[model samples]
Target: MKFKTSLIALSIAAAITPSLVTAEESDIEVITVTSSRMDKPVSAIPNTVTIIDREQLEQQFRTTKDLSTIIGNLAPSFSPSRQKMSNTGETLRGRPPLIMIDGVPQSNPLRSGGRSGQTIDPAMIERIEIIHGANAMHGLGAQGGIINYITKKATGDNEHQVSFDVTMPNNLESDGISFGTSYSFSGESDQLDMIGSVSYRNNGVYYDANDQMIGVDTTQGESMDSQSADFFIKLGHNFDESRLELMVNHYNMENNGDYMAVTGDKENDIPTGAIKQEQPWEAANNQVTTTSLTYTHEDIAGQQLHLQFFNQNFEAVYGGGCWSDFYDPSMEGNDQVTVCGTGDNGESLYYEQSRNKSVKWGMKASMIANNIAESGINLAYGIDMFRDTTEQDMVVSGASWVPESTYENIAPFAQLDYDLIENLTLSGGVRYEYAKLKVNDYKTMYGYGDKEIQGGSPDFNETLFNIGASYQINPSIRLYTSFNQGFGMPDIGRVLRDGDSFPDENPSIDDSLALTPIVTDNIEFGADYQGEYFTAKIAFYRSSTDYGSRMVEKEDGSGSFVVKREKSVIDGLESNITAYIGDYDDVGVNIAIQNGEYDSNDDQSVDTDLDGANISPNRINLFWTHNFDNDISTRVQANFFMDKNFKDASDEVYSSFDGYTTVDASVAIPVYSGTLSVGIQNLLNEDYYTYYSQTVGKDTRYFKGMGRTATIGFTMPF
Candidate 1:
């Protein structure tokens, strides 16, 4: 399956590239409000873009188990599950991408576990805009790409709407269940109009044909649940022939889940008394809460102002008898170690509770103006400021081991977009950021050392810039090129610990080390066309960097224990085509392909050429949608991912996961002036894995995706 997926990806790329060269122009124009903070047509922009409408989102969510699956199916090889299964972490175009809600940044690089950004209820989303390639105009740190989530706003009509859903499966009838409902009310009696919505969702773990737990542990009988609420209010007044408006929005989410991990071995009177490294169990719990508020005004002097604030709290705890409070030096290397004179997997013998906290705040304001009275030129500028702080502490009941340390960053930037020629657009932007870090005074574990290690305030100041231009070859086609810079600073927790190296019996030397920032220079070229029958886009990018992040190996050179800095380069290509086949029926099809690779890497240090390396090389997404009549319609989609290569040189072993394709079909039927949807996902009952990783000398699996799911939902209009 993996090999076939890869081949199909290559074939799709080969086909889309040529189609881009021959794409023609279309007359339909869709207005966008993100790039310029004002309404503008997509064709007027200088970049490749993809928009996911509300209908598409509803169709996917109704059939899939979670949003993670939606992301993986749409973009080949892009998996959120990879964060837990793979140690190296997942990146787009060889680097971490940026995520934004409305116009606010949600990425906190200093947060533990690297889980940034908040999840939104799909029913509240109006549309999603995806911008491929480096985003210099959006400010620094956007090396790979950007995703902007634009949610639904308020309406003035005095009406309410609600939606609800329930799911079914091809196999286990008792194990599958899900339901959510949303309500919206609007009125126009006073100067203010408002809309409020609340949603709740819950789902049990899914099992595959093999009767395996998939990603969950049957021992825990775990499940996931989430609750969200959103509200928007718009107040406006008419003065003479002009009007002024004010818009405010607020969103909140609370989620909780249990996580599963593989422990070594479990046996009565186990040697080392520490469970063997291959036993699987559900031992951790995660809870997160996020809140955001925004205020904005539009149509004011070709200028707009936006202010946003966000706060998120996350907590993770190891549960059960496995999480005890005790440290016995005698348990170092012995199999039959004692924890308070009793045998308990290293927990009671040597364990400590860990907790992490993070806070982030940022705001941006931008303006756009045209030289209507000057040289017929257009200009755009914006300034932004952001700050983030994090702290982690290890606690055992009432006692503390690792002290709490904090890291913070302050950044401010400005950008300009100008029309240098009649048919060309030029842009330049720069950001200067300063980071401050401090480690609170603390004592070493086990009284191993007396003197506390104080992290000297390490500060970093960086300047990032980019230049780009777009040329209008004609009304049907446009060419664009850009050169930009990207950077990422060393994280707070890893900044102090250098991993195991240089000694086993040193009490005076500080084990923590400070690292430097990694930067990259990226160049890109792309073209877009809107023809009579089809719309196509193709882009190529190259990234060269002096410093890169990779896993570091121990002295024995058998495995990895640390993340080291290296130098490398990456290049890739992306292309897609959308065709309108019929006018009477309004039928259309869309296809996309993406390829990427690392030109140079230092995986040999960890004993593998493929470790810490993954490129889609090829991906194919196909969608067919038709409007059968005014009130009814149907759609079908197929997503395929190529097989990826995983090799560990030290172990002298190579493994590859076969790729598979997922087929989805859906239909909308109008009942009593309401919309009813029915859909089937994974229609072929194809069992495929989304991630693969090694644990304790053997390979383990997280999920096999979903076999087959059927959903029925209804949206009512009062």
Candidate 2:
């Protein structure tokens, strides 16, 4: 499937690239990036990286109102959006990337609750940096790559801004309407600069392609029916040859949907629907607060030194008892227990709720030394130390689902960039990581037989390395090759909950029952070409692992599963091209072709292919934008997905996702004091199920993409 899609996409690129003529040569703005710990020009970085500036973010948000979807459309290797709050299967380079907010980790590595993608509000973001592929610069959870959301910074002398926006469905439907407002203030003096902003948003119910109420996903949370708010502030003071900065941010969101899901008929391609229900509890809730302090000294003893300390607190509450089914054995003889208490007789009953809470604190220190031994070599060395504590429990029953676990990690790394020759550079890095985990003994939930699970402490120490080289063929082109190692641990909570224990049994933790970490070796080769009016890049990479963790279905077909470690291999090619046509029109195309396989039988042959749930299918995205002289711009975008069969076909009634295409359009114009934006998502209104919905057999999981919904909003600034 990927081969066929690649051919077609390449053909389209060949046809479009030559038609757009180049404009006069002009100096393109150079973007500075901090993904590698050392600041460098994006063009000089020997990896696939993308930067989404504030302007682009605002424009994209007008169309999708989702951060993950915007990134998926702009980045070639990223999977298509799931159209939901949880980004469970949205992998990059066939693996999940570590998400960060202002260099502070947001991902829950120990449990992977899948809510990290939306930890921060897009309204408060200044820009986003995406580093693709594996590297050792950031220790742990970089198997695929990293995405950092850079918060807004103070600009200009003294600025104060206020904005408000409101949007509703084009058809005048009462559902799916939204309203938002924000206020920002910034000031700069000779020594100090500061920026602060606050925002609030309220979202209404969602409707699908058929203009019908969409089903509620109590487990993962739905963005369409939520209320969110955010507050951010940053202060920076510049001293002679040194700088000090402090930042604080708080975000909160909660689902307010008053409906519940009703199963649909999958054989006929019918999606689940929602029905009014007597409220039991809020669907989902999330809150996050972060604080950080950073100090940098330039030319300290002929070297640059930087230090950062950060802390974060997070809590998430999920709706109902979605995790498992519960019944009172003592009440089995009474019909009232089955009918009245369980809501089987049409009477509403309060639903059980679950919550996850975590706290994380970390510090990092690094130094950059130049001209080592007068050999035209630059070196960056850093040490990172962090600790995280996480726990999950039932809100009503006070039963522990996952016991409080504490993880501490300390890593030190060094990287060198050598100017081996004029126009040629070599880079290498190595890191030593020491991680320790501690968990106390606890009793399992009543639904899990109330077993006493003994906890254990584990420690790991490993050394990882990376090497790369880049050759500047000319001012317009460059070639590069790299090899890197990445490491990550399995979801420990998943492993512990799958133990073979009952109410009458107690098991002790041992090495045999402990989860092991996974290590991946990645290799890539790529080329970049930049012209006065056009830019293009192509990269081919291969990643292999001896023992990688994956969730697989159990043989009993009870909707329960366990995590297994197996040999796996993933290889892919990604390409992107953008052309500026006469400065008024811009066209771009992105293609991603990838495949993954694992050794399911343990024969080490890697015979079983991975599914869309694990690996993204071949995808192509194209966009064209036109700008008018009157401060107006319009953009049209299209996305296509290729059909691919699943590796595990037994559980799926429909084993493959039928390919589909979608198009969206948006226009922006300067209004009163700010901007007015109008967009029509799914312009064609093609009623199609998402890849995930098509493959999953469960009726309640089937969801169709949104319809041709028109949105118009104006932001007024004062």
Worst 10 residues of 2 by lDDT: 14-23
Instruction: For model 2, name the residue pairs that clash.
Output: none
Candidate 2, residues 1-718, lDDT tens digits: the string is 0123553455344211111113333333256777779876665667777788887787787776678788877875777777777777778888878888888888887777777876777878898888787665666687888888999988856887876666665455776787778888999988789999998988876676678777777767777778899999999999989999999999998888677777877888778777877446657888999888999999888999989999989898877643233333333454332232443443333346678888999998999998888998999998999898988876755556778888899999998999899989899999898998888887665455556777778788889988889898998778988898887877776666554422224575445333677788889887766777666777788888888888766776456556778888998887777777776997878888888888878888687777666788788889998999998999898988778876642434236778888888999999867888888888887778877777653687787777777777667545
- Those runs of model 1 whose alpha carbons end farther than 4 Å from true positions after fitting are 1-11, 14-30, 33-41, 75-77, 80-90, 136-141, 187-189, 217-347, 350-353, 394-408, 443-452, 497-514, 551-561, 584-617, 646-655, 692-702
What TM-score, computed on C-alpha atoms, does each candidate reach?
A: 0.78, 0.92
- Regions of model 2 farther than 4 Å from truth: 1-29, 322-350, 501-506, 512-514, 555-558, 648-654, 716-718
Assess each prediction's global lDDT (C-alpha) against the native.
0.51, 0.76
True lDDT of residue 195, candidate 1: 53
lDDT per residue for candidate 1 within 538-615, as digits (tens), equals 667776666655444455432323455655556666665556576523222233333332323355233343342333
